[model samples]
Target: EAAVTQSPRNKVAVTGGKVTLSCNQTNNHNNMYWYRQDTGHGLRLIHYSYGAGSTEKGDIPDGYKASRPSQENFSLILELATPSQTSVYFCASGDTGGANSDYTFGSGTRLLVI
Candidate 1:
């Protein structure tokens, strides 16, 4: 089964501060993604990578960046944190079959900006 895990279950950040959220996967899948979940909105993709050393912007990549240094690790970087960016972030991994394939998501990282 594909498994994804994220660090710092909860975080509080000051405005304009930088924050890095880490994710690790055990399934060795080629696709990894970062998404933020907010009330009244569906999970919006922030970034994704097909494999290590490759990161592509997603639907909501404005305040975020991503890095994938290896098959098992991916990180989301918030260069300038803001209250608007405060939300639950989830990391996911899945097969390359697109929508037909189910993605396994992490527990989520709740970020609170002050």
Candidate 2:
């Protein structure tokens, strides 16, 4: 079966350091998304891409960057990690056909910046 996988399920980074979270999908979905879940706030989109070589800024892309070098891979980068960035990040792959289209999500990556 197809799946979405994320690396380094958990990570601890120092403030001002750089962190890169990666995602890989076997579902062949054309759309990939990156989101972060915080305590008070719900899941917020950080960045996304429609396909290879196309990355778009999402609702909350201030402190994050995204790269889609290939159709099956996407990466989220934190150039300057900070405490406020500590959260559970999720990666998802989906189709753009319709609203009912299925979306496969990775387990999630828990990041802590101290």
Residue 26 miss distance in model 1 (angstroms): 0.3
Task: State how far residue 114 of model 2 sits from its true place (Å).
Answer: 0.5
Q: Write one digit per residue (lDDT tens) for candidate 2, span 67-96.
A: 999999999999999999999999999999
**Off by more than 4 A, model 2:** none
Q: Candidate 2 versus the native: TM-score?
A: 0.96
Model 1: per-residue lDDT, tens digit, 1-114? 657889989999999999999999999788999999999998999999999999999998998989999999999999999999999999998879858458889999999999
| Cand. 2 Cα-lDDT | 0.95
What lDDT score is found at residue 94 in candidate 2?
96
Task: Per model, state how many residue pairs clash.
Answer: 0, 0
C-alpha RMSD (angstroms) for model 2 = 1.0
